[model samples]
Structure formats: C-alpha cells, structure tokens
Target: MTRVVFVLLPEVHLLDLAGPAQVFAGADGFGQPYTLDYVAERPQVLSAEGLPLVARTDWPVLGRDDLIMVPGWRGPVLRDGPVLHASAVERLRAHHAAGGTIASVCAGADALGQAGMLDGRRCTTHHQLQDELAARYPRATVVRDVLFTTDDRVVTSAGIASGIDLALHLLAARHGPALAARVARDMVVYARRNGNAPQASAMLRHRSHLDDTVHRVQSLIDTHYAEPLPLSRLAAHAGVSARTLTRLFAKATDGLTPLRYQQALRLERAEHLISQGTTVESAAREVGFEDARMLRRLRR
Candidate 1:
C-alpha cells in the first residue's frame, strides 16, 4: 500500500486536512488501499475551529511517502511567531529531497515557502494572502485567481474549499480520471474532475468598480444563456473590439475565458434550478444549453 501522511500543524483548518485525507483514504486504486496517517510537530494540535487533533506520530515519522499534505497553518499570529521549530523545516526538506510528492492547502503554502521549497515554483494560496506570498517568495510565480496550481513535484491550492479540488486533482493524477470522478461523485461534488473548470469560489468575492463592458457582457450571457449569443454583437454592445473584449473578459473575470465564464454561469443556474425540483432537461434549457445531452457532456 502507498503511504500517505498529513502533517498537521497548530491552527490547521479542519476541512483542509479532512478533505484530502478522506479522498486518499477512500481511494482504492491499483487494487490496494492507501495507508493514511496524521503526524504533527507534537502529539496534539488545535484546529482553527477550536477542535483538537491527536496525531499518531510526531516529526520523527517523516519519511518516504507517496504523498504528504500540509494543511494551512494557524492565522497571522502563528505565522509571525518566531517559535516555529527548525526541525520541522529540515524534515520537510529531507522528505522532498527523497522525492516525496508535496502538497499544501491554503496557507499551508506559507510553511513550504518558509522551508524554501516553493522557490521558483508556480503556486497559489487564498486570495487574501496573494500579495504577502508574492512579497515573501520573489522567485515563485504566485497566482491568486485559480483554485490550485501544480508545478512538477509541488502542488498548492487556494483557499479552504479549494483543498477538496486539489485532492480530487491528486487522485486523478495518481490513479486515473475515472477514479477521481468516482470520488468526486461520491462526495456530491461533480464539477472538479475537469481541470480548469470554473469553481464557485472564483466568483464569490465581488470586486468593486464594475467595468461596464464586462458587466454588460456577463449580464447578457446570464439572462440569455438559452439564446445563441454572437461574440461580435456582445463586443459591439460593450463598445469594445472583439479582441479587446476578450482581454477585458479575462482580466475582469479572474482569468476565465469569456465563453467559459458564460458556461459556468449557466451551469450554476442549472444547479439552482435542479435544486428547486426541475428536471435535468428543464434545467439544461433554462441554463441556455439547448440540449440536455450537451449539458451532460460538458459537465462530464
């Protein structure tokens, strides 16, 4: 069995740790189960939600692994604390040197950055920490808009819920898309198997100073998803060139392509309709997908 370890830190987000742990622990690929364990710098750690986690082992157990996950650490106070033991850093370095796959959720990237593992790697974290991460790790390409980023050996996820997305991705990477899709379906999270799909978290935080062109384009797509929308017409209505509209769409919508953002909005609306007892076909039509088959195909 492949061994998977989660290094629990003080003030770790409970969901961030639990999401990946459940995915890997439940993943029965290669006709064998994974051996999952939780370790910490000490025997016990408190979660951000006031729950306590009791670890099975301490830092001495850091060894070869199929994967190692680090959940986000405590908030800013713990981050600024000078009491972080150097032994934890050395152990992570040693684990990475031995070719272990390293993954972090949310602010857990801060620990990896502190250990100098994320230097020159493309990574992400919660949007609130984007500027701080960029300032702290000059060599790293810090992206804020995406759910997660994988650069060879290191993988980092943005925010709390994105940890689940990252775990699904890891399952897909290690096992196969089929198994990953199975896990996601089992969790009732249907949209994460396809990489680059727009996540709800992408649009949760509203930006001020609405760009009228982008707003008009999005409003049209939202209200008229069932109708065929010509891109040229949309651009004209927004008073911008088609090419310029594309650029602004990407910038205004957190790197989502215009068409993709529209599709996501439609899907979100479809989900809402479904929750209200609408049939899948009705929901599909309501969301601007003319055919139910197309909606199923795109989501799958």
Candidate 2:
C-alpha cells in the first residue's frame, strides 16, 4: 500500500492540512488504497482554528512509493511561523534523498526550505509569502500566482484550497485522470482547478450544470478523451438526440461543444506529455490526433 505521511507543524492551518488529507482519503472511496500517517515533533499540535490534533512522534519507514507532505501553519507574518524541529527537517531531506516524493501546502514551503528541498527547485506558496520565500531561498525558483508547482520530486502549492488541487493532480499522476476526476466528483469538487496544467481537467471545467445529459456526455468524454467520438455517440450515451446534446453541452460549458471539450482534454494531455520530453508527433498520437496537424494548429 502507498503511504501518505503528513508532517504536522505547530499551529497548522486547519484547511491547509485537511484539504489535501480529504482528497487522499476520498481516493479510498474510489478503490485506491492509501495509508495516511501523521507525524509531528510533538505529541499534541494545535490548529490555528483552536483545535488540538494528536500525532505520533515516531516516524514511519517510507520508500519511493510514499509521499511526505508539510502543511502550512498560522503565523503573525510570513517569516514568523513556527520553526520546524531540526530532526524533522532532516527527515524531510532524508525522505527525498531516498527517492520519496515531498510536498508542501501554503507556507509549508518554509519548512521544506529548512530541509534544503527548495534549493534550486521550482516552487510556490501562499502569495502573501512569495516574496519572503524568494528572499529567504534565493536559489529556488518561485513561480507566482500559480496553484502548484512540481520539480524533481518536490511539489508545492499556493495556499489553502489549492492543496486539494495539488493532491488531486498527484492522484492523477499516480493513477490516471479518469480516477482522479472520479475522486474529485466524489468530493463534490468541480475538478476544475488545473494547478500548473495548461488546461483544466474535464471533471470540473464543464461541470457547473445540473443537466444530467450534459454531465453524462462529459463523463464519457473525460474517460475516453483520446478516442474518436462523434456527437451521435455522445448523444446516444446521454439518451438524447445529437442536436439536443449539442445544445445542452453548449449551455453547460459556456458554448463549448462536446467535441471542443474533448479536444481541450487532448490538447492539455498533449502539452503535458511534450513538457515531459515527448516529441510533438508522439504526444499528438498519444492524445488521439491522426497527425501533428491539429495539435500544431491548436498549439498555435
């Protein structure tokens, strides 16, 4: 089983921790088995919301399949949050050095900095602390106004609810976008937050409607985005005629037909593959394009 360990800091922001926690926990409802472990330097950590949280002081053994995360905490100022224990910082470094994935939510990036994980990495945090984080870790590349960033094995989120976006993206990478979308749907999240992805995931982007027909069509498109799908097939799945499916789809997704939405998913996946060093032609083929022609046109 994959282990997800959360390092609880003193006065941790409740949502900062809970958002990602709930995301991972919801994955279990979708048949993804993940063991969650909470570790802290102290036995009782208080939340910014005045809730006391219990954690284990003893660390768990983790490996490459494991994920260790730091949740942001409350502070008077960006530079004034609770300082992480030396041993805790060492644990973060050791985990990453062991090929484990490390992540942070909001101001938790500060703790990762203490672990030296931010050194020469691309990361971000709550906008309020972006300047402070950059000034403190000059070697790190801090991208502003983004939900999350990933470099090497380190992932960081902007703040608060973005943690959910970060966790969902991680789930997509581990499992697949279809599973991640189901997880997001189970949580009532629109799955619209793209984090650093070039385009939003279909699970949430065109999902702001109560039309069951449109939703069914979108669900079909999301799971089979790389396949050639005609409007007639989508309409058949939705139990509607092709013209009605087109009209309802437009009404649901702000004028985007089912075909356009599928293309969006394809383009987004293609861009991600290309960024990971896949050739444009290969990426296009992988995302269902007959050739690079449409991909090139969409990219342009």
Candidate 3:
C-alpha cells in the first residue's frame, strides 16, 4: 500500500487540502492501495475557511514508496505565511534523502522551499504567489503558468484545484493512464488542460470537452488504443454513425479524427516504452503498430 501523508499547517486552504485528497481517495475507491493520513505540528489546525481540523502530531513510519504532501496555507505574504519549524523541515529533508516523494500545493511549496528542496529544482506554486516564491528562493527554478512540476520526487502544484491535476499525474505515472482516467471520471472532473497544464497523458489531455458521445468513444479507445479499431466499431460504442462520430470527435478535439486520437495514445505509450530501452520494433509491436516505420514517421 502507498501511504499518502498530508502535513497540515495553520490556516491551510480548504480546497488545497481537499482537492488532491479527494483524487487519491477516489483512487482508493478504484483499489489503488493508497492509505491517506493527516498530520500537523499541532493536534488541531484551523483551515483558512474557518473549519477546525484534527490530525496526528507524530509522523508515521514512511518508506520510499510513501508520499508526504504539504497542502498550501493562507498568507498574504511569505513573511506572514505558515512556517515549518526546524524539526519538520528536517523531516522533509530526511524523507527525500530516503528516496521518498514529497509534494506541495500553493503556499505549501514555501514549506518545501524552507526545507531547501526547491533549490535548483523546477517547481511551481499558485500564480498569485509565483513571483514572491521566485524571489525568495532564487536558487530554485520556479516555473510559472504550469499546473505542476516534478524534479526528482519533489512535486509542486499551483494552488486550489490544480492539486487534483498533480495527483492525477502521479497516479498516471504510477499505475497507468487507464486507471487514472477512471479515477478522473469517478471524480466527475474532465481533467482540464489550459494555459497551466499538467504533464497530461493523452487520455486526460484530449478529454477536456463536454460531449458525451465523444467521451464515450474516447473511453473505449483509452482502454483499447493498441487494438485495430475501425470507425464503424468506435461509432457503435458511441451510439453514433461512423460519419457523425468522425465529425463530433474532430470538433471536440480540435479537428482530431478518432483514428488520430488513438494513434496519439499509441504513440505516447510507444515513446514511454522506447525510453525504457525497448527497441523501436518492439515498442511498435507493443503499442499495436504494424512496424517501426510507422512509429518513426510519427516521431518525425
């Protein structure tokens, strides 16, 4: 089981804590084996939304596979922001040194900065706080206009709802895009990609529309992208005629035909296989390409 620990601070934002928490919780419903825990410097931490929350005071026994997440808090400025005392900072450092992943959202990235994890690492926070974070941690490469960034295992996301994107990205990487899609579907979030986008998988990136028939077809393709799926078959799954499915898919996906979308999924998976040292021919076969030539053409 992967244990996800949320370290709370005084005046933590409600959505920043709840958004990613719900994503992981939804993943748990899908049997992802994530065990969630909440911790705080004090036994009771009040949320910025005026809700009092209770949590454990002691840290858990965490392994390298466990995740420690710091959800952002409310502060007009860094000087007045929540602070992680030296002990908590050391714990964050120790966990990362042991190969455990640490993540932050919004002002939570400031806690990571306090731990020196942001130094020389590409990270992001809420858009409103981006400039201050960059100025405060000059050694850190604070990327702007991104939903989130991961350097080594130190992940940071923009505030509020963007935390959901960060968690979904982690889920996609750990499990597969299929399960991640299911989780997103279960959460009723279309997994938006905008000016600030996650390292979105094809399944999530192309699913930002509200067309039910298109989404149904896309869901079927997500699970069976490596198979040879003709327009007739895809159309049947979406309960539409081939011609209409073609038009709707194109309109919903910025003119991408169903075949094109499936090819994008296949190509993305093939790239991942190739990056893992699989030969081009083998990766092509794994992703249902007839030959490496097609894969090479797509790469070009």
Candidate 4:
C-alpha cells in the first residue's frame, strides 16, 4: 500500500488540505491503496476557516511515507509565525533526498520554498503572491499564471481550489490517467488537466500585456498542441528570429523554453479532460499525443 502524509500547521487552509485528501483517499482499484494520515507538529491544529483538525501523529512520532503533501498556510500569521516549527521542513528535505515525492498547495509553496525544496525549480502559488514568491526565491521560476507546476519531484499549485487539480495530477502520475479521470468524475470535477494546458486566466493576460505577438503565440499553441509547432514557423508568425523570439518569450512569459512551454500547455489541457472523466487514450490523443506509450511516459 502507498502511504501519504499531510503536514498540517496552525491556520492552514481547510480546503487546500481536504481537497487532495479526498482525491487520494478516493482513488479506485487495488482496494484504495493509499493510507492517508494528517500529521502535524502537535495532535491538533486550527484551520484558517475556523475548523479543527486532529493530527494522526505528532511530527516527531510520524512514520515516513511515499508522498508528503503540505497544504497552504493560513496567511501572514502562519507565514510569519515563529511558532511554525522546522521539523516538518527537515522531514520534507530528508524525504525528497530519499527520492520521495513532496507536494504543496496554494501558499503551501511558501513552506516548501522556505525549506529550499523549490530552489532552481519551476513552481507556482496563488497568483496574488507570485511577486513575493519570485522575489523571495530568486532561483525559482515562479509562475504566477499557471494552475500548478511540477518539476524535480516538487509539485506546487495555485490557490485553494487548485489543490484538487494537483491531487488529480498525482493520481495520474501514480496510477494512470484512467484512474485519475474516475476520481475526478466521482468528485464532480473537470478531469485534472495536465500541467501544460493553455491558461486562459486574466492574470496571464495582464502579464502578457495584451501584446499582439504574445497573444498570437498563445493562440497558435492552443490551436496546435496536437500538431507540429516548429520554432521557425512560430518565429515567422511572430515576425522575429528564433533567437529573438526565445529572448522575448523569456521576458514576456514565465521563463519556460518555447518547446517546454507548449508541452506544458498540452499536458494541462489533457489533465483537465482526464479529470472530467475522459479516457486516457482519448485524452492523450485529444491533447495531441499521437502515441499512447508516449503519453504514458510524459504523464509520468
């Protein structure tokens, strides 16, 4: 059986913690393989929404796990709380070093950032804190617009509801897109879109400055994720050299290389359809993966 440990702190966002718990706990097949536990610095913690959660074990006494999920912190109070212990941080680092997966939701990225797990990696948090997160973790590629990001074994999501998306992504990774889609259907959520789906959020529009070139690129990618997108063609459409396009893209976007950026968009869309209960093969093909084997590899 797989074991998942959720690290809870005072003033934690209840949904940020509960969303993922429900997804993982409801995973189908193998008799619900995961053993989920809520472990905290103590046996009890208060949620930002005023709910009380009892930890299954105190931090020091908790056992190791296949995955460690850190839910978003309450607010400035928890973020600045001197009482927020570092034992969780130490355990997270140790877990990652041992090849275990570590994931965070919403401002939970802040906790992971504090632990240095996000250094030199791509991550996302609630859009409202993107600037601060980027400023505080200069080495991290802090994405403000995406729903979530996963790199180097560290998975991070945007605010509140995005935790559901993150959890579905985890299911897809551990089991398969088929299983994830089932979970999403049972939960009545659009299937977990892959991490790379096109983001149609207002935040991205603001950051893109409504620039014609940027919009064109995004639009083209959205329409052509399944088709081949050569850099030369994309640059030609943008009226710029490939090199110039790359440079401008880095400045205009969230620091993803053009190819990587496109792939991310495709995956994001795929995950969404899957979460909405789309079949794995259909979802992969819908997102432009011609080969099911290829989609499986990339999903992992």
lDDT values for all models: 0.75, 0.87, 0.88, 0.78
Among all windows of 10 consecutive residues in model 4, the one with the lowest summed lDDT is: 198-207
Q: Rank the candidates by lDDT, best first.
A: 3, 2, 4, 1
- 138-254, model 3: which lDDT tens digit per residue? 999988878789999999998678888888888888988778789888889964233244345678778999999999999899899999999999988888899999999999999
Which of candidates 1 and 2 is the stronger one according to lDDT?
A: 2
Q: In every candidate, how many clashes are there?
A: 2, 1, 0, 18
Candidate 2 lDDT by residue in tens digits, 212-248: 8888888888899999999888888989999998888
lDDT of 1 by residue, 1-300 (tens): 677778787788898998887777667643547878787768888898999999965543444557777888657532472233587677678788898778899888888888888898998888778788888889999976777888867888987878888988887777777787777777777556332433333244323327888878877766676677778978998899999999988887677666786676677667656654689899998777867997787667
lDDT: the better of candidates 1 and 4: 4
| TM-score list, all predictions | 0.68, 0.67, 0.66, 0.65
Q: How many Å off is the CA of 157 in candidate 1?
A: 0.4
Scored by lDDT, the top model is: 3
The lowest-lDDT stretch of 10 consecutive residues in candidate 1 is 193-202
List runs of model 2 lying over 4 Å from the truth.
197-300
Q: Residues 1-300, candidate 4: write the lDDT tens digits.
A: 778889887788889998999998888343558878788877888998988899965543333448898888766533463243677788889889878889988888888888999899999888777888888788999876788898978999888888888889888887788788788888899446556543354224424554567667767776676788999999999898999888777777767556767777666666667766788899888877886676677679
- In terms of lDDT, which candidate is stronger, 2 or 4? 2
Tell me the alpha-carbon RMSD of every candidate.
9.0, 8.5, 8.2, 9.6
The CA-based lDDT of model 1 is what?
Answer: 0.75
